[model samples]
Target: MVKINKMLKSLHISNYALIDTVDITFDNGFNIITGETGAGKSIMLGALSLILGERADIKAVRDSGKKSIIEATFEIDDYPTLKEYCLANDIEWDDTMCILRREVAPAGRSRAFINDSPVTLDLLSHVAMQLVDIHSQHQNQLLTSPEFQLRVIDSMAGNDTLLSDYRKRYAAFRSAVKRLHEAKRKIEQNRSDEDFTRFQLEQLDAMNLVADEQEQLEHEREILSNMTDIKSTINGALDALLNGNSNALSLLSEAGDYCEALGRILENADSLAERLQSARIEIQDIADTLSAFDSDLNADPAELDAIEERLNDIYALQHKHHVSTVGQLIELRESFRARLDELENSSFTIEELEKEARRAKSLAKELAAQLSKRRAEEAARFEADLRERAMPLGMKNLQIKVELTPTELSSTGADSIRFLFAFNKNQPLMPVGGTASGGEISRLMLSIKAIIADKMQLPSIIFDEVDTGVSGDVANRMGAMMQSIAANIQVMAITHLPQVAAKGNAHFKVYKQDDEHSTHTRIRRLSTDERIDELAVMLSGSTVDNAARANAKSLLNIK
Candidate 1:
């Protein structure tokens, strides 16, 4: 695995430059930050986290009336995922990408920007998760979350497909069970409502309604019943306009010709000529319309009687069904058919469902058993690995128990695993955070993290006061352990212990200085000489005593 060497090369902070605004660059391998109690040591870690999407304190921003901006330039190793992201998001990448986070503390609002583009907190958190794992002092407590435990077991199981299939089966079974209950309730309801249902079905069926045919037949009946009177009216109108002695076309034609002759004598007679011509055409059109109507108007008494009977049948059905339109009748027909189908086969469906549910119950129990066995094996190995890493962190006789037990019908197979432990062999096993002290919990969390680090594919691990409870030989062992861990990965620690602080390949110091009207935090990447001086100060407080400097100088680990 590639570790951060010259990565996170530079940092720039404005309006948030601590007591003394300063720009700093980092070195490779291990970096340690140590200072006096009130010297703002944790501020650097907090700023880094804030830029990584952690919410910052409202008052943390400077009173200069400008937004706080934290910009970090990084030289990342060949990370294909990050490279793909940069390309996709239009971020320029050349072995380096700039992540800039800005917080507008004026409105108590903060914004995170990666390469100067505003991003949502979730996206910032996702990108930050790929870049860093900031282990806060309180992060140790998150290890005991039940959801976290279940996630671990499922990850290790590597049988997610099988578990997915099991969950699908479980869901189907639950649905079947619910449906079966509803059907039974419906049957009981039908028994109580048997008389009403029989009455509705019988009444609907007796209507024997035809769907669109009823509306079509009624229109045919209306036309047929009026045929005789319609034919007589059309004939009389056609004769009056065409064949009568005073027919309109005969009178209009003579008048039109007379006006045409008068047009030669008078200017206004031109209008009369056009009007006469239009009037003759209107008379012809009226005669043609009546002729067509007369041809189409024939009366047949037998057909009229048949049409009337059809309409009566439709009206009778409508009255019986209590519906006003043929469309409503169509809907009633469909409803009747659907309910009839349901009543017909509800028995067969219930029988098949009962059989399938029993089969599902048997299969679920079988798979759950196999899943529980695998989890037990994984749990044992997991505990062994945790205890092995915990030994050097002042946790001798520390016992880690991965308790795998069956939960009641969970989608994730059947196993529920929890991290349980005891400080000594004879002591009862208690949860990592509940019964164990803070120091013990911290060590346990570190041990667990160490055990999973390689598998987790994490390149850098930041420890915030991880050495708070350690002392003497145990503290010395921690320093050596961290150095060994650093040989393969980058380890940065915020420590008070000289052993841990002295073990880093690089060191920095954070301090606060007062100005004319305000306080600011200043951080400097310490050189060998500066580190030694700072370590001396950390060891002896205000008096740097020669022995502390000598101790700082002599401590070194191989690259």
Candidate 2:
């Protein structure tokens, strides 16, 4: 028997319900815990649940003023995959050990940590699931669930990659179908508005709108509206400069003649004469410009009417489109054109989506068929192996069958599975949940766990009184099965049966003690002599006797 390297090493719990503080160190192989009912066994499991990321309740606090904390330590050097997961999640990874801790404050707030680094509860749970599998009596009800049944078969078939591929294909198929449906809906809706959109686009195109056209046209309209005032202002400026200024050019000419006469007597008079001549030339040019303006300034009613009509058309289009600028109206027209184009090409788009959907569906169907074939082949072996493992636990007449019914393609696959069972010959097989009693279910679950333990490489498994309703040789056989499973991984069982308790490499007893203020639950590892006494008490109803001790020693294989 090879020992598993990755196993839970120790647990520390403090200030939790019914437990002030307790530190438990577990062995690597089969470890047994025995205690009377209500002796804090369930409390211990609850504390363990905290480290597994279960929701923390304020009611579980032993003292309302203090915080409750639970921590678990595991050796994980052999699990490189777990190391990779931690590194990928930005969690600090330890080479040889990983510690998981949960803290619940008195204010009902909770926090989780991995290797002392803060983490979300979801991340903690994801890592913890890979570390431990805690199977309780309540899980027996899962026998009725088809999902769980199918999961068990898949595990046996080693269908992880195949199932992942199938689900990916199925997801693609669903997406394609969704896109096709959306395209069809949009096409139908756009078809209803097609005529109106085309009309709007045609109207805007016929107008031949240009960006900035509205601003330019408004400036032109202002000039045309005030034409008489603008023309009068220009004529007044022209008369002041040249046309009516004593006629300024004539005045400048007289000044130049006087300066020419003075030049014979005075030297500066000649430069003054040149200046007056230049001034006369400037005035003449101004007179010529004014004359041209007068000739071109006549107001034509016909051209004004045309300009007003064009402006009115632009204003009407802006008002109709609720736009203030020609640019905005242009954008609206393009949007209408685009919508019409989509309506026209909708058939091609729908056809392309249909092809994609068909391709995805075909691939999904092929993968689902492969998954179904693998599941079918493994289902037979799983049934046979379960029958062999369960027979020694007083289920010799157990007739087990796996039924796979074809289902439509889904995330899991294209099959629905159920475990059918009958405990006696000539009895009709029915679903395990309906046919198996509580004890039978317990035994069956244990057997299933035993068969899958090696395949799963589970580091540790805790069975919380899974040996609920069996005794004598059946209990002994169940213990033997657990011992066999422990060879490959860590196994912990909390049981009351002496036969089962005697098979452990290490044993712990949970008990209650009372002080003056309150009662406390404590657990301690039992020694060799203490084991005999505990087993004797369990066998003889709290009374230890020579015969019970002999029976316990015999069960423990002591001489």
Candidate 3:
């Protein structure tokens, strides 16, 4: 037997639904709770659900003035996954014990706590799920679910690493497909705008716009536009300075000669002669500059027209590109150049992306095929084991077949697996849901779960009235199976069957107590004698005769 370390240590529930307060401590093996109809065994499970992060209601508060509190403690040293959850949630707990608590107020508000530290309900649920599996009748319905079916097959095949690797690659493949689509979209969008971009670029390129070219053209235009005025002013200045006999340069020369003659006699006269000579040289230089300007200022209409045409083209190009200066147009042109370059390379980029997507898909297909192959093998074994388990439960004629048919590749694999069943040997196998009765399904589910339990490590298993429609030897066998399962892990059954109830290592009874104004439900762990009486009451109803007592004792192996 596997050594059991993680178990539900205790549950403390107060002012919840029917019970005002009930505190129960659990042992490590098979613990059973039995009660008459409408007794509070289900209520106890309900309270347990609250601490496991089930939604709560104010109506559950037995006393209007007090809050309903449900707290559960577990020994979880063996569960590393749960310990990781505690670390992730920053909950304070040790290997020996951990506490989960839920409180619901009269106002319908609720709060959850783990190890005295408050936590989100989601986090609390995450920790709770790792420690317990409450297998109610609803979970039996999950046997029909494909996701659940696949999970069982995967667990059986010990395909955690394979399935995990396949899923990761599938995710990558999906991502690669998404990226390819995005890249194609970008290319399509760019192509839509490419023609306009090329037209704009061509217009600018044809103009050959240059930085500072526009300013230079404007200056030239101004000169050409005023060429006649410039020539007249320059010619007049040259005449005044040098061309006339009484011009400024001639006057300065005459003055310089007089000063030179005077300078032969006086030192001041020589200084005056030097000043006149400097003035004459400056004026002559000015006249020569004006003469050259006059010669160059010919108003050539053809050249001016050419310059005007070029300026117009530059201005038009600037307007078309929505720019003010030649520099901005040059920048715009380079941007268009880059866009065209990208357009040219987009085909190559798309090809690469498509190739990558294809590789990812191919790898995913191979992994899926491997997963399907392994699952098929496990399914065959599972079918055999399930039928074997069922045969002992009075279902000797049960035929369970696991069919793994090929389908499109998905996250799980390329298989549409189903469990086919036929109760009679001559009847053709059909889907389990269609062929099996409720009781048959319940037994089938228990058999499957037992098989799964052997294959996997579940912290605890609870059967909430799973033996609803069966009795006699079959019920006893079910109890024996539950007992056998408890050898490895904690098992609890909320049952009404005395046969099942008698097999529990520890037994508890839920009953109701009445007051003047109200009735409240409560539970108590039964002593050996008390267990006999309870089982007797379950076996013989409200009237427990001597025969019922003897039968109860025989079921319990008491003298």
Whose TM-score is greatest here?
Answer: 2
- Candidate that scores best on lDDT: 2
What's the best-to-worst order under lDDT? 2, 3, 1
Q: Count the backbone clashes (under 3 Å) in each candidate.
A: 4, 0, 0
Q: TM-scores for all candidates?
A: 0.70, 0.74, 0.72
User: Looking at model 1, how many pairs of residues clash?
Assistant: 4
Global local distance difference test of model 1: 0.71
Q: What is the lDDT of residue 411 in candidate 1?
A: 72
Worst 10 residues of 1 by lDDT: 1-10
Tens-digit per-residue lDDT, 425-540, candidate 1:
68988877767877777776666665554444454667788778778777776776666666555677788888788888778787787879877778777877788878777667
- Which segments of model 1 are wrong by more than 4 Å? 1-13, 16-30, 48-56, 69-104, 109-133, 153-204, 214-233, 240-332, 358-366, 424-426, 457-461, 480-491, 502-506, 514-517, 532-554
Candidate 3 residue-wise lDDT, 358-383, digit = tens:
99999999999999999989998988
Please give the distance, in angstroms, between residue 45's alpha carbon in candidate 1 and its true position after superposition: 4.0
Local accuracy of candidate 2 as per-residue lDDT tens digits, 414-489: 8988899999889899998778888788889889878887776665889888788788898889999998899989
**lDDT measured at residue 260 in model 2 versus the true structure, 0 to 100:** 84
Give the least accurate 10-residue stretch of model 2, judged by summed lDDT. 239-248
Q: For model 3, which pairs clash?
A: none
